[model samples]
Target: MHPELYLSYSSAFAIGLLGSTHCLGMCGGISASLSMALPVGRGFRFRQTLLLLAFNFGRIGSYSLIAAGVALLSTQAAGQWAWAGLLLMTLAGVLLIFMGLSMGQWWQGIRYIERAGAPVWRTLSPLTKRFLPVNNAGQALALGSLWGWLPCGLVYSTLGWAALQPTVPSAALTMFFFGLGTLPSMLATGYAAQWIRSIKSHQGVRKISGILLILFGLWTLPIQALLNL
Candidate 1:
């Protein structure tokens, strides 16, 4: 990978990691609920773990699909107009800054974006219900995949950043790694909800993560200048 592209992927990963504290609060309940959907047995522990992994991987797959579509559209737009890429990148930077602020509880600007997605979620939310009382890993996975579209600022912001990548594959890969970065916290939410919540509630942790994300957003602003230098 080019150094800059590598940095982009790394930034995506970092955003997922840092922003995951919010994810715990947002998606944690659903994850824990899935655990209840699992059947009781001597193999319950193994089954629960498998289902959780399936659910999360499915969610990640959903993120990849969204990123792919965004990237395709952005790439096509840029092809038609050279300035489109610059415009998209700048928009992505602004979104990231908003996400960082939201994560830090310093602003609620991203909530508007979240609300804007409500109509889509209303459509998708019903699909998730169909898989409820998940009896198998497949059902859990499907439910999780559907849950990925749950109007999250962090997820949308990350997708926006991924869309700014020059290629579809790069954008897809960015979302993939970002999903991986979120796995730990999200997984913990199912088994260790209180611990994850404690981490999310810590002001110092949020502040530091927010600052890092804000800097990452700032870094994207001068991509062309940096490339030339």
Candidate 2:
């Protein structure tokens, strides 16, 4: 992969990692419930792991699908209008900065963006009930896929970044890595909810993560590219 592409993927993953505290508040309950719903037995741990994996797999799959769809439209627009690409990148950087602010609890401008997605979530939320009280990995996966559409500023901000990628597949892969970065916290939430919660509640951790994200967002801006020209 090109160095720039590598940076994009790495930054996506870092966003996921740093912003996961917010994710815990949004999706952690459902993730933990998946484990709680399972029956205890000799292979309980194995089964729980399987279901969690399946659920997260589906969730990440949806993230990638969304990224691809967005990138498809973005790349096409950029093809017709050179300025569109620059505009999209600028939007991505701005969204990331907003996300950092939200993550740090310094500001919540991103909540408005999340609210903008509420309509889409309302349309999809009812479908999640069908997979509730999940009995099998398939149900868990299906439920997770729907849950991925839940209105969250962090996800939306990252989608903007992903859409800035040059191609649909690369955008999708960028999101996939982002999902992977969150796996540790998501998985831990199932096994150690209290511990994860404490970490999520740590203000210092949030501030540090937010600062790093803000730096990443600044780096993502196209100012250097424009300056070179």
Top-scoring candidate (TM-score): 2
Model 1: lDDT equals: 0.86
Candidate 2 regions exceeding 4 Å error are: 224-229
Regions of candidate 1 where Cα sits further than 4 Å from its true position:
39-41, 223-229
Q: What is the lDDT of residue 120 in candidate 1?
A: 89
Displacement of residue 146 (Cα, Å) in model 1 is: 0.4
User: Which residue pairs in candidate 1 collide?
Assistant: none
List TM-scores for all candidates, in order: 0.93, 0.96
**Candidate 2 deviation (Cα RMSD):** 1.5
lDDT of 2 at 16: 94
C-alpha lDDT of all candidate models, in order: 0.86, 0.89
